[model samples]
Target: MAELSDGVAIRTITFSLLSSPGLFFTFLTIHYIYRSYLFPYLQPSMSPAHIGVAIFALSFQITNGIAIGGWLGSYGPTTSSNWAKHDLSVYLGTAIWALGLGLNVWHDDILRSIRRRRGVVEKGSGEKVYEIPTGGLFEYVFFPHYFTEWVEWAGWWIVGGVACPPARIFLVNEIATMLPRALQGKRWYVSRFGEKKCEGKKAVVPGLI
Candidate 1:
């Protein structure tokens, strides 16, 4: 009886940890879909190649969902042990992700309202969209969404615990690949909006990098 109870408890805990990362990433995956596929498809200067790259990057994280889910199922212990220790890092990390996501939601709503007021609908498709901005966070940073996204994965890494190679790989790829794009994006915005207006905004990190 004792062994059986322990086994069930362990299984439950492992399952929880394994599932938690997937859930966090899911929110992000959905967020990207809403923006890339559903929202516009209508950027004035956006090219087919740019759209393709965007889709590739957005889909990359979602693809990890399968690997993560599989890891939890395979190596996950089926018996309760001393491994069920609570880490405050996980909670704090999750909170940061939630906060970033919340900011994005609010920002989108504000931009959407502004577009409605401006009477700017899609060119021929009739879908509604907010135009690219020169104000708010956009006034300072070109890729706030990318910034929050980086933070979100960092949070996932924290909550998902150490030695999670899959999470580390995801973070590494994002940093290596996206960081350059972010810098380019910053330059793009500056060219469009002027550099003087973008004071005090770092490229990726707040004050550094």
Candidate 2:
């Protein structure tokens, strides 16, 4: 077996590499909750359902984490033939995800600017109107976060040279869980912003979905 200069076994290296996405996603879920939900709650008023959604998101994240761990643990490492020689696709996909994440930040900043300009006045529902987000990704897609997430993990699989079976399993699980949530969120957006705002925007994927 090929050995590292430090005498680390190739199996150890491969296993660790395969497990990286699981750990990364775990960290992301933690940070996402704190930043997205906890920070919003620090204000005087926030809807109970918003908190509930946060909890639900965390719960799903936990399930996914466990699934990833089990998958990686079972597979341990990917052999060469297990995945196609498409390493370039892995890098390209990762860059796409990074761009999506950057756009997410940009979208948030724009919302913050709008909120600041509009001032923080309480709405009739006792919640601040248009405080979170409802344009760009929010308007165009219900779960851009999840979209980016799937893209990110797709990159992880590519980079690790993981095969299609595990990737398809994850995809199926995401569609089962997230698709309904996306549809619900789309309905909420339409109710709030009107059908005009959501025009030409698909629920999850763009066209061809």
Winning model by TM-score:
1
Candidate models: Cα lDDT each = 0.59, 0.55
| Top candidate when judged by lDDT against the true structure | 1
lDDT per residue for candidate 1 within 1-209, as digits (tens), equals: 23332344333443332445444456456656866775564333332567787688668757776766544444433322323442465577678767766666555555556655455446555675444454545544556656666777777666555656666777788789878987987677567657666566666665664
| TM-scores for candidates 1 onward, in order | 0.62, 0.55
Worst 10 residues of 1 by lDDT: 77-86
C-alpha displacement of 161 in model 1, angstroms? 0.5
Residue pairs in collision within model 1: none
Off by over 4 Å in 2: 1-86, 108-119, 123-139, 162-168
RMSD of 1: 6.2
